[model samples]
Target chain A: MEENSKLSQFQPVKSIFEINREERMAPGHRACAGCGPMIAVRQILQSLDVKPVVISATGCVEVTTSTYPDSAWLVPWAHVAFENSAAVASGVEAAMHALKVRGELKEERPVIALAGDGGTFDIGLQALSGALERGHRMLYVCYDNEAYMNTGIQRSSATPFGAWTTTSPVGKEWPGKAEIKKDIMGIVVAHGTPYAATASISHWKDLMTKVRKAVSQNGPTFLHVYAPCNRGWRFEPKDTVEVAKRAVETRFFPLYEVENGRYRITVPVAKPRPLEDFLSLQGRFSHLLKPENLEVLKELKSIVEERWSKINAAASVQVQT
Target chain B: MAQFEPVQTRKSLLTGDEAVAHAVRQSSVDLVAAYPITPQTIIVERIADFAASGAFTGQFVPVESEHSAMSACIGGALAGARAFTATASQGLALMHEMLYAASGLRLPISMAIANRALNSPLNIHNDHTDVMGSIDSGWIQLFVENAEEAYDRVIQSFRIAEAVNLPVAINLDGFTLTHSTEPVEMLSDEVVRGFVGRPPKRDSLMDEAPKSFGLMSLPDSYQFFKDDQSRATTGSSVTISQVEGEYAKLSGREHGPLKIFRPGSKVMMVMLGSYAGTARTTARRMKNDGEQVGVISLGWLRPFPEKQFLDALEGVETLMIMDRSVSYGAPAGPLASDVMSLLYRYGIKRKVIAVTYGLGGRGFLEEDAMRLFRYAGKSGSSFESFFFYGGE
Candidate 1:
């Protein structure tokens, strides 16, 4: 993990502009300056060769980008309620199938549902599970920002352990959030889908590659991308990418994919960094650094290490098979 | 508008559920996403059977929940496909959030709501509570009196909904009409195809030109979007009547926003849905016995045909408003509230008696209607008129 994190820092920044010149997602939207999800969405859209019909759940992306009458999407997009994007995408895919069968639609168009962690891991889990289990030919992209930032930084199931949020504040006998983040990628993988992967905005190339690969697949696909929020995390806007990179280095958000029940770790970290390296950068975990809260840090590190071991074990078993 | 002569049709005895399925088959629907719910289950079951038998070529998606059903319908509609779904009380309530999403996006998805009473102790019988609860959902609502009207309205709903780009809810009395078999003269597939025609391809997600749908609106622009929705819903009145006129020519039956049994009468009873049929029968018997009683049945509820309702009530001495749904703690039921508001707005002063009846599928009889009309006719101002019938 230490080696990969160092290598990422020294590696030259690839010009995404030269790779794909067309901006399917237009500029001048309502996304906050230095918003991590916005950058991830642009890169993901750029990776798609076909113009996708984007179904967005009610969250930061939907509210910021398409604010009634004026929309930032240059591609065909829709924003339904908060927790039914996947279900809506299933409908769109069914319609496309019907239209294609009737010879009304000529070209193949991919249906993509974009949601936040609050929509994906929490409220929308049932709909997402149904869509994946039904094997709809669609891609569901969840921008896991750790908390519900759009709703004033409330703690969702995606909020990391010991992270402070509005609902899980750090004060009065409580250090921060008492629970670990929900394992949403594991749940998606369990559905036996054709493609399911985890990506982060800090690693744009990896994210774009996985997006392209997922979109090319035939059945249901899910891509959970790590997105850091500046306001919610109490970080400087410029440190969004840096915070996201540290998260991967510390094994907080591992980059991996489960394709056809086979596990593969995309960005392997040889020596994992300490969890403090990632948590110290954000004020959400500032309370954990106090002298009395050392046990909380230890607990968080142990959890991360345990998760890393599980992923590695799964990869080794896949290799043997 | 060009007119086609009424073509010979086949008569079939079917329940309201089967009638809806037949109408869906004839309308050339592109997709259906639905969840099974009581009183509304047979509708989807029949549609699924039609799909299995190769009678209907559309895609049938049996979703997990009513929320997903509406969500899927909205998705299909956004992709430029004619989509539909059906549900009853709880299922409709589960779909309450998506209901707003469908209309706010203006997806023109048609839904059949088997009107059943909501649960306190859990009742799966007939009432208007389900549809009445969604009065402000921005969808055009049509109440059918029987299986034949249910069949015809479902077909006309597609044209009205698609032409106006608004979701339409066709309400049929659960169990009363949904389970009771009745003879309906069905239009041929060719005539329905010509009547409904092909839904014009709109600027949708499938189109080459990229468009955004169901966008979020901030406070600065949210009200304007609502205003646009209001205009679309209200503006659909003309298209509704025109489509009904066209449908009347094809089916040899006329339907509209409201149906007035006796135009000019001293005493009138106003209601909606299948209960109007019983009221009409009682009114005929009363008229024969020298009492001037008439029935005005409301078809459209969301647009709330104020002009037509007021015109029908003109010169009537007393108006009795019948509602199947209660507005707890309020002075009257939902229908009575709207009726009184309309009467108050028009500066018309007359004795208006509001009564709530047939809740949770309790049978509403013609005797109850006659008794209520008689009591309202003779009672002075001190009468306790606001009450629920057949309730403890």
Candidate 2:
């Protein structure tokens, strides 16, 4: 009962658009018109109440917002390099404590590390694990666009099975990527983070609430946000959010949270929509719809179902014994 | 120079690593983010002891890798903290990428490099090869010949880095200086505090004013930043000297870009690190034996100290450059190549030989220095050349 009360302080934003809060990310940036990660960044920044020092990995968000002469960030932002955002945030958090020790700083600002999927799930995994294990008071947000969208869509570990990336292109003999997406949330939770979750741009309210709860934690927290890339996924730019929502509704990407080893389905889908509703909107998975790739489609569906069942079991309210 | 009594000190036996730890502890660093690599591990371990015993109040982050160590230092520096880290050889190689980032961002973070040989057969011993790998990384590199100089340079590095807004690397020879204990005079914490002076509040992420750092640059403005970095490095020589001058007032000890022993001798032998001490002793003995020999320790490798080097080269007709690292297919070793380049730039012609020696931490005996000095003394040929000195 007391554990439930610990999470009660986080007030969820009822709706993102209804709030008249000033945008933390300034306009006139270089992000694409329907950039999904940009929307996630905006909502994440808007959700924060306390001043935050944002550390970014080298990716689309860093490049687009922080061009040489101008920057779109209205808050303290740092982009060090690829594969070390978590490590950098660890330093910043440590510095905040040290500064307070020396009486140089009064109030310690929160630290939020942002990275793309490539930075989070692949080259950056070790650093992220170290940061989380060290229990630094910081929030790490991985905007999972499924591939290295900054350097033109190379397949990352976060890329779903059978998705056609530039590296995993469709060929006569070769299909698309053969492997399934890595279970990053499982990896993050294994580090015993105080809070870790999966969210999407479509569910801004849940995402914002998670951000608030993450910042309020005394130790490390993580958010694996499903950021759909329009150009990389080869979808109509305007349908980025719709495709993201389809991912959630189809059970392909579930919205959930793992708090102190306890799992809860924050947004449960009792009856998932057809998987086709999600895959059909993005060209990366269009090859899976063909009859020749019917087995691959079935395999993907079974995998998603198995994952959904597993998460549902984990988050079940019934007594396991 | 202003006249003042040197700060009171007590002498204690300390290794190069311990000397650096003492300096860092006294400098009031806000954060120390470092990974343990041999030859440099003692530094972090001693600082850890300081933190545990309450002698040092700074935060110590045992980072996962050298790359993360540097990355974290950058983060701490950006947050307006006095940041430090230490590494050697393979660790420095791993951190090669972020070294440029730290300097390019103009973060005044200081680092200590226990100079060691890079791995081929995976050896860990004293050599300049490790630091030479980063010769072009746009950092102010200071070389120390012994524990005392290591102690002095570590303190002076913070002043130089903060003054010029560039990172400083104080390189002490692995095992040779890092493990060898010497009586090092210590400065009080209050004295070091007065010297470095509160880290000089820079624009930080923690500041009220929001700012962006490490921005992406297109072709048009990329070179402008690089040019600025280049100028800042070349211009840091002034701050380097000025800091040493101030440190001299308090510590009564000062080191310059070049330490010349027996200046204006027709035959001059030059090197860096602990072996330079051997060369200096050899030169003194040979001078007493009626040989016109000179020895120079090139202390600062970066900023190259063009004018000072040229000045030291005056009336020195024969130059034997002792390098602990190979440049591999270049005309000479790394140090010899730089000196040769400096001479060529000025059209100063002389008999110059680049002799590579003490590689992979091979001990450089005083007799070895004597042999090099005697060899340079006998060489009658004019012009420049290169060779291995310790080969069978």
Candidate 3:
């Protein structure tokens, strides 16, 4: 597990402007400047080869993009509620099939569901599981910001250990969050999805590639994209991308994909940076760096290392086969 | 042109649930997304059988839960498909949030609710508690008296919803209408097709003209959207009457939103759902016994059939209203509250005896209806109003 094993490598792209695709998400919407999830949203729309109908669960992206009387979406978009985007997309896919069978529609468009970590890992887990298990021809993208940022930094299952969220405050008895981040990708993979991947906004090329591959399949695909929130993490807006990049470098959030039950580490880390390098940049983790909380910091590092080793093992087995 | 000619019909004995499924089968629906729940389970089961046998060619999605069921219906409708779903009691309660979502989006999806009681000790019995709780969810509510009305309303509900650009719920009593078999005169597929016609074209998610749906509204425009929805719902009475008029011409069955049996009586008994049949029979027997009594059954509750309901109560000075559900901390029952409000609006002073009965699938016989009517008609007992029947 100590040896860095690379299965698939992504070429470093010089700029996002080189990819010649129409920007389906219009500019001048309500998203905050330096918002990490909006970057993922823009790239996902640009990566799509077909005209896709988008289903959005209630969150930052949905509220910001879809204010009444005006919408930032240049394509068909819908925001149903907070927890039912997957099920809504399933219905849209089924309707597309039905319409095609009846010859009412000339061609079938792809269906995509977009939600946050709160929607995906917690409230929407059942719906996501149902959509994946039913094998709907759609792609579900979870833009994880680690907590419920829209509701003002409430702790979610996706909130990491030692993170200071409103619901998981740093108190005398409790350092920060008492629980580790939920393994949502594992839960999704256990559904036997044809394609599932973990991505980060820092790696735009890798994230876009996975999006294209996901929609090309004739079954459900899942993409869990790590989005760094400057507001929630109490970091400067300019440091959003830097913070995300450090997360990947520390192996805190790995970039990987699984296709047909085979795992492939997309961006393998040769030598991971120290966990403190990532934690020092954000105020949410500043309390954990104190001398009195050094033990909690040590535990977090071990947890991160253990998760990285598991991914390395899973990818290495595929290489050996 | 089809309305000018004689229509061919077939007679079959069907429970209310089967009748709704048959309507769906013949309605040329594009999708039926539902989850199985008691009483209403047969509706989806029958739709599944129809899908299996090729009688219904629509997409039938057995969703994981009622919340997902309603969500899928909203999605399907947004994608320009005529979607339908069914649930009962707890299932409807589970779908309460999405009910507002469906109507707020103005998706025009039709649903059949096998009216059942909400559970505390978990009873699967007939009551109006589920839909009563969702009364403010903004969907057009239609109450059916029997299997035939359930079948007819299911078809009419589609046209009504589509015409008004809103969702409609056909409320049929759980077990009483859903399980009890009754003879229904089903219109032929051709006649039914002609009656409903093809769905009108609208701006949909799949159309060439791209538009966003279910957008968030802040304080600036939220009230406008709700005002528009409210106007559309209340204004649906005109469209409803027009569609029912057209349907009556074709099927020779003319049951409007409000029906009066033995109108112009001094004392009237008003209620909704299948119990109206009992009230009708009981009212007749009491009239023969030299009592001035009548029965009024309302089919549409949301739009409230205000004008016709008032006109039917021309000479009535007293009303004995029966409610199958209770409204805790309110002045009266759900239906009675609406009636009282309508009376207050019109400045019509009538003594109202608000009574609750037949809860949790309990049987309501002719004796119960006659006893309530007699109790309300008694001269000196008028002071003691607003009580429950068959209860301590």
Give the alpha-carbon lDDT of every model.
0.86, 0.89, 0.88
Q: What TM-score does structure 1 among the candidates reach?
A: 0.94
DockQ of each: 0.69, 0.82, 0.68
The TM-score ranking, best first, is: 2, 3, 1
Please identify model 2 stretches exceeding 4 Å from their true place.
Answer: A1-9, A16-20, A317-321, B1-9, B383-392
Candidate 1 falls in which docking quality class? Answer: medium
Positional deviation of residue B277's Cα in model 1 after best superposition, in angstroms: 1.6
Clashes per candidate (backbone, < 3 Å):
3, 0, 0
Model 3 reproduces what portion of true contacts?
0.70
B25 in model 3: Cα distance from truth in Å? 0.7
Candidate 2: residue A299 Cα off by (Å): 0.6
Query: What are the TM-scores, per candidate, against the unseen true structure?
Result: 0.94, 0.96, 0.95
Task: Give lDDT: candidate 3, residue B276.
Answer: 88
- i-RMSD of model 2 (Å, 1 decimal): 0.6
Model 3 score (lDDT): 0.88
The candidate scoring highest on lDDT is 2
Interface DockQ of candidate 2: 0.82
Output the better candidate (1/2) by DockQ: 2
